[model samples]
Target: MTVVTQEAGAPFGAAPPSGDAAIRTRGLTKRFRGGQVAVDTLDLSVPRGSVFGFLGPNGSGKTTTIRMLLGLVTPTAGDYSVLGLPQARALPKVGAVVEGPAFYPYLSGSANLARFDAADPTAPRGTAARRVADALDRVGLSAAAGKRYRNYSLGMRQRLAIAAALLGPRELLVLDEPTNGLDPQGTREVRALVKEIAAEGTTVFVSSHLLAEVEQMCTHAAIMRTGRLVAQGTIASLSAGLAARIRVETPDAAGAARVLAGLGLPDVRAGEREVTAELGGHAPEEVNAALVGEGVAVRGLAVVRPSLEDVFVGLTGEGFDVDG
Candidate 1:
C-alpha cells in the first residue's frame, strides 16, 4: 500500500535510493516531435525484491518511460535512478528485454547469446560458453540452445531473448510485453519464469497490457491511462481502495430498502428480489441486524468487493484490453 514519493535528490544527498527503491523517478516527462506528450510528470517508485507491473493500454507512454529508465531515450524533463544509482551508472546491474530480441537468423541460439555476452566489455575472459549454457538452462531453453534462431518458434525466441539478459547476474530485470505474441502454453511458461525469477530475490519490472496476467503475477502494480498514472499500489490495496457493495435478495425488498434508508445508508435501490446498497463504511452484520430487527426476511445476502479490473476502470473511466 505504499504510494510512490518522487524525489530529485537522494535522501540526505547520499546519492542512493530514498529507501529500498530499485527504480525511482521524479516528474519524468517525455515529449516527442510535434509537441505530443508521451509521458507526463511521472513519479514512480519500485521497491527492491518485488515484481512490479507497469500496466496501461497501448501507447499510454509505458514504453517511453521505460526507454528513459534504460538510458535508451532522453526524458524531456525530470530524472530517474535505478538500483540506487543513476541509470547510466547502474545499468551494469540491470538487464532488460525491450521490443524483442534481434538475432542473426543463421546463428544458433547459443552463438547469439555468445555474441551478446561478448559485447559487454566488463564480462570476464573465457567464460562466455559457461554463461551462455547456464543462461539457456535458466530459461528452459537448453534443448534449443543449438537450434538456429530462424527455426525457433516465437516462444522459444522470446525465451532466448530473456537468456541474453541473464548472461550475468542482475539486480533488476525490465521486460516489456514479454508475453506478446505467445500462445496459451507459452504465456503460461513465461509467467512461470517471471515468478521463478522474482523468487530468486531479483526485482522485476514488467510492462504489460494484460491486466489479468499482471494481477496474478505482480506484487505491486501501477496503472497508466493516456500518458498519466491513474493509480499505483499493492494489488490488494488498490482493490481495497474501491467502495465495497452489498446486495440482499429478499421478498420484502421494499421493506428492506426502507430499513436501510432509515439506517443512513445511501443509494439503497429496491429491485424485484433484491435491495442493494453501497456498504458505505457499514458492515453486512449491521445491515442484517437492522433489516432482521424490522421483520424483513433475508433470503440471501452477498457482498461484492471491487476487483482490480473494477479499480482500473474506475480510475481510468475505460475498460481494459486484457492483452499485451
Candidate 2:
C-alpha cells in the first residue's frame, strides 16, 4: 500500500457544488496485517443522479472500499471525493450503510431515526423528520415506521436502514449489500426505490453480488475480482463487445444440423431441439438465410445475449455458483 497525506479539514458548513460527479476515486487501496490486500488499486467514477452498482464475487473488497469512503477505515493509498468534496473533507455530506446496516434492535424504526437526527447537529429536527418521512415512503415503509426494529422483519429492517441514510438528505447514498436478506418482493421494492432516488437527482452507490439485480437496476456498473476492478461501463457497452450466440430450434434436428454446417461457420454445436453457433456479425437474417439455403424448416430462433453473470464469470475466471 502506498502512503499519502490525508486531506485536511472537513466541509461542515455547506458543501460546494463541485459539478455532477457524485463520487470519484483514484488508485484507492487498503492493506491489513500479514500482507493481505483487501482493496487493490481501484478507480471509480459515480456520476450524479446515477444509480451505480458495484458488483463482484464475495471477498472482492466492496465493503472495504465503502468503509474507506465513509472514513471508517483509512485507505493506505489514493484519494477520493464524495458529492464533489474530498472524502476526508466531506465526511458530513456522505451517508452510508456498510455491512448489514446494523441498528440497535431495541429501538423502534422511528425512534432510531429520531436519535440519528438529533445527533446530527447540522440537520434540523423538522427537516430531518420530513426527510425521514420521505425516505420511508420512498422505500415503501411508511406503514412500518412506528414498528420496533426488533419486531421488524429482515427486509423491513433493511428498508429502515435505508430510511436512516436519507435522514440528512445526503446527496450521495452508499449502500453495501442492501438486499442481502430481502425476499423477492422486498428486493423488487428496494430496487425500484433505488431507481426512484437516483431519478430524483441523488447519486446512489450500491454494492451487491446479485448480477441480475444490478443489471436490471444500475445504469452503470463496475465489476471487481480479487479486490481489483476488472470491468467497468454501461451494460450495453460492455456487452456489445462480447460474442453473440444463437439458440436455435427446429422441427427437423437433422435438417438444422445440415443447414448450420452449410453456413460454413467454424464453431457449431448441435444438441437435441437446439443448435448453438458463434454469430459473427450475422443477424437473424443470416440464420434465416442459412435455413433457406439448406431448405431446412426452422421452428424458432432466440438470440442469446450474455447476461452479467456470464460476463462476471468470464472476466474473473471464477464460477458463479459459490456457496457464499
Candidate 3:
C-alpha cells in the first residue's frame, strides 16, 4: 500500500490530505471532558469513489472520529478535509448517518423524509416531492413509503435513515454501523443497498465492527485499535502483507520439514502427516520440487493466503466481532 505523509515541517509520518482523496486527516484527534482521549492522532486517506470501511471494535473511537470529520464535534487537534474541501465547505455535498437513525415515531417514512428535505436550506422547495420519492425508491423503501416510523421493521428503519441521507445529491455517504443490531436478512439488505449506492459513483465511508460487513462490502479498509489506526489499504493489499503458507501432506513429514528448512523456508513445522512453512518470496513449485527431489512423497500441496481476520488480528493483536 502507498504510505501518504504530512507536508514538510509537520509531523514526520503524519498523512496529509490529497486532491484525489475523498476524505483526508492529518493528526486528527478528539479528547472528551475530564481528560478522556476518545481518539488519538489519526491520519486517514479515503480515496475518492471507493467504498472505504472504517473498522474497529466498539469504543475504538470510530463514531468520535466520524463526528469530528462531519464537524459535529470539534477535534482537540489536527486538521481534516471532506471531498477535498474544508468540512463546512463540503458538507453540502456530503450526506451522513451517524450513531443511529432517528425519526418521529408517529410520522410516515415519506413524511419524515419530506420534513428533512424541507429543513435543508439548499434543497429547492419545488423539488421536495420528487426528491423524497426518488430517495425512497433509491433505498428500496418506496413500498413502505406510507408506513409509520414505529411500524417499520428494523431493516426498514435503517433504510429510511439511508433515504434521509439521499434526499439531495450526495457525493459522499458516511454510515456509522449501518448494519448494527440487524438480523441476517436485514444485514444483507443493507449490504446490497450500500453496494448499489457505491456502484453509482458515490464515495461510501462505512464505520462497522462486523468483519463480515467490511470483507464483503468495502474495496478499501482502515482498522483501528484503542483509538488509533493500525492499518489501512485495499483489502487485497492488506491481506497480501501477511505471508502465505505452503502446506504439504506426506507420510515422510520429517523429511518434508527437513527439505523445506534446507530450502530456507521459515517456520517449518512437521505434524503427524503434514509439513507447513511460510512461503516468503518463494514459489510453491520450487518447494515442491525440492521436497520430491529429496525423496519425500508429497501427497498434497497447497498455498494458503492469510484471511482478512488474520491480517487484522496480526495488526491489532485483537479479534473482531465477526458475528455478521
Full-model lDDT for every candidate: 0.82, 0.75, 0.83
Question: Which residue ranges in model 1 land beyond 4 Å of their true spot?
Answer: 1-17, 269-272, 319-324
- Clash counts per candidate, in order, are 0, 0, 1
Q: Write model 1 residue lDDT over 236-313, tens digit each, in one string.
A: 877776667789999988999999899887778899999988788898999999999999999999998877777666
lDDT of 3 by residue, 101-146 (tens): 8999999999999988877778899999999999999878899999
Give per-residue lDDT, candidate 3, residue 308: 77
Q: What order do candidates take by lDDT, descending?
A: 3, 1, 2
| lDDT of candidate 3 at residue 49, scale 0 to 100 | 89
Quality of model 1 by C-alpha lDDT: 0.82
- What TM-score against the true fold does each predicted structure earn? 0.86, 0.85, 0.88
Q: Per-candidate RMSD vs. true structure?
A: 5.0, 7.0, 4.5
Highest lDDT against the true fold, candidate: 3
TM-score of 3: 0.88
Better of 1 and 2 by lDDT: 1
Can you tell me which runs of candidate 2 are displaced by over 4 Å? 1-19, 251-266, 317-324
